[model samples]
Target: MQTTETLFETFKNVLALSNKNNDPSISSERIAEIRKELDSRILPETPLAELGLDSMTMTWIIVKLEEELDVDASGISIFEIFDVQGLMDELIQLRD
Candidate 1:
């Protein structure tokens, strides 16, 4: 099992790449805010919605995960995942 810190970093890195040059609406300040939310002490039960991620951001995240992690996120529904831990769990499963 991946450590919580590692998972957090993984998500953070992917999120940065996902937002890097693709969307103009996700301003630097917005990214910073999102990072700050990720940097917080997130527990397994923490809801993803609390992080201020919308559908578009989630879509970018899925795309980046597929491109960078070599995992197929096409079958995953952004709305189906309710928590940070669930998201990480899904990613790890896909990787395996």
Candidate 2:
């Protein structure tokens, strides 16, 4: 079983990758801001949409999780991604 810190790091990495690819010119300060917001959500049920991530960004994140991390996200429903913890749980279950 992966610890909470490990899961948070994975989540943060995936989001960072997505953000970098989506906006190559994004500043480090902005990235830090994003990370801060991401890190603040310690609760499992924090709504994903509340992160203010765009649809394209989410798609990239899912792809990165599936391809880079080998997390099987085939069963993930966009609507069912109700919280950060839920996504972490699914990733932990599907991680290779």
Q: Which number leads on TM-score?
A: 2
Clashes of each: 0, 0
For residues 1-96, write the lDDT of model 2, one tens digit per residue.
Answer: 557667777777678656787789988888878777666654466688776788888877887777756666878776677888888777777764
Minimum summed lDDT over a 10-residue window in model 2 is located at 37-46
Candidate 1 ranges with C-alpha deviation above 4 Å: 1-5, 16-37
Instruction: Give all candidate RMSDs, comma-separated.
Output: 3.5, 2.6
Which model scores highest in lDDT?
A: 2
lDDT score, candidate 1: 0.73
Residue 40's C-alpha lDDT in candidate 1?
60
Q: TM-scores across all candidates?
A: 0.69, 0.72
lDDT of all predictions: 0.73, 0.74
Query: Model 1, range 1-96, lDDT digits (tens) per residue?
Result: 455567667777676656664676777777777677656655668888876666777788778767766778888877989997888888787877
Off by over 4 Å in 2: 28-33
